[model samples]
Target: MTLRLGYGTNGLTDLRLDDALGLLADLGYDGVGLTLDHMHLDPLAPDLGARTRQVARRLAGLGLGVTVETGARYVLDPRRKHGPSLLDPDPDGRAARTALLVRAVEVAADLGAHAVHCFSGITPPDTAPDTAWQRLTGALAPVLEAADRAGVPLAVEPEPGHLLSALADFHHLRTLLGDPEPLGLTLDIGHCQCLEPASPADCVKEAGPWLRHVQIEDMRRGVHEHLPFGDGEIDFPPVLEALASTGYDGLTVVELPRHSHAGPELARTSLDFLRRAAATTNGAAPC
Candidate 1:
């Protein structure tokens, strides 16, 4: 399977959507991890249908695949970053988050995206773990149904510091969902390095069957920083090899939102780095 390289809009936060798409296309990216944010797609914008159609047309013209990412802070709550999440104390807040994700599922369907990436939000203070899990699953249930109806996969990302923070958590989510077919994993390599006991490659290998999407970035061991290619301790070649071994054909998005100004260059460099690493690991090129 051909490994697809995509860039996340997080890294292009400063650029307008049109400019971001242009940069991604020019940089040889095959797709885009379109973060649903106010500055970018503006999911809360009126006339979402029209905007979705417009984006679909533009991406088609550019021959770029799309993946909806719903990790935008403050989209649902202006006062707090990622607040009123699935595990929020209030039921209305949980419903609001679910509604947003359902809209995202519709957008992904309209864009013909392979999947939409979501996450388990942080549990509030003094919340019981079981209660948090129940709340998160309850909130996600309708969203997953909407995704199934829209013919899009709902890929949950296991993030550091979030309710679901590792491969085991992901497995638990899948099991909780009764192993639903459309439910899958969006494995963020850097997060795995930061949170999982296994190496990123091992994590991917273990979660191979459920893996549907991927996010790649370098990060120091035990830290949550999203670093550039060589800045962190990750051994990316084996990670890529594991993905290849699993026959993962989904987009492997490069996410480094903190380096917006340097996004284009970083995207190009990261793609080149991954290609060279894959070649070396596959024995097609010398290290």
Candidate 2:
């Protein structure tokens, strides 16, 4: 009854991609949340298929699973952070983002990744709520089609301050998309702690059926910041128990994108913390 834990590569920006993967493998992590970025696999790079094949081999050799993450801050737009979102007012801007996500689905298939993680970006200013919803639904349609074709689940995350900021918003999206099979949820534990009315453990239980990917970190209520273990108000043991009970087989990835300066050290310590927490959970041992 253990959860397979992994770490996100976005937190290891300072290390080479090879070194980062090797480091996680050596640390006994079961998988990785691989963010497609300029430094790590570079989704837009030339010969992307060859690069993806090489990474597939690396993960296979290391016995590590993967989930392709599409939250690279500047992969598409150099000047804007997470710009050209699904809800962008400009049609071309939204298409660019959709194309990137489609490419991500291809990469995920090649890597044999568990899922492809994404988010509906922040709602554009001066936009009506209904219009924003229309833009998002329109934008994600092709990406979902790509996921269906690739046999990969698209795990859309509910990011704080974004268009889809909560669990209800995700349900709204599901309803809008007509409950597509390839559509699934990436539930962030910290997000629950930060904004959800229910406890994080309860959120896990409620989201179980739709869960495809899970990102975890310690965070205080009402704050969106991602914190290391023991630095926030989350009670992790119950959350782990709930997660294990859900029968979700995907990686519960440690997401610390801003902690790359100390990525290796945090990777080691974070695993230790999760293992200890899992040990306390009703015999749900962590690997």
All models, RMSD in angstroms: 1.9, 0.7
lDDT of each: 0.88, 0.96
lDDT of 2 by residue, 1-287 (tens): 77799999999999998899999999999999999999989988998999999999999999999999999999999999998899999999999999999999999999999899999999998999999999999999999999999999999999999989999999999999899999999999999999999999999999999999999999999999999999999999999999988999899999999999999999999999999999899846788
Q: Which ten-residue region of model 1 has the weakest summed lDDT? A: 278-287
Q: Per-residue lDDT for 1-287 in model 1, tens only? A: 46788999989898899889988888788899999999988888997889889889999999999899999878988899987898999999999999999999998998999999999989899999999999989999999899889989999999889999888898898888798878989999999888789999899888888888899999977899999999999998888888888887888899897899988788789888877777766622211
Error of 2 at 124 (Å): 0.4
Model 2 regions more than 4 Å off: none
List where candidate 1 sits over 4 angstroms from the true fold.
Answer: 283-287
**Count of backbone clashes, every candidate in sequence:** 0, 0
Tell how far residue 163 is off in model 2, in angstroms.
0.8
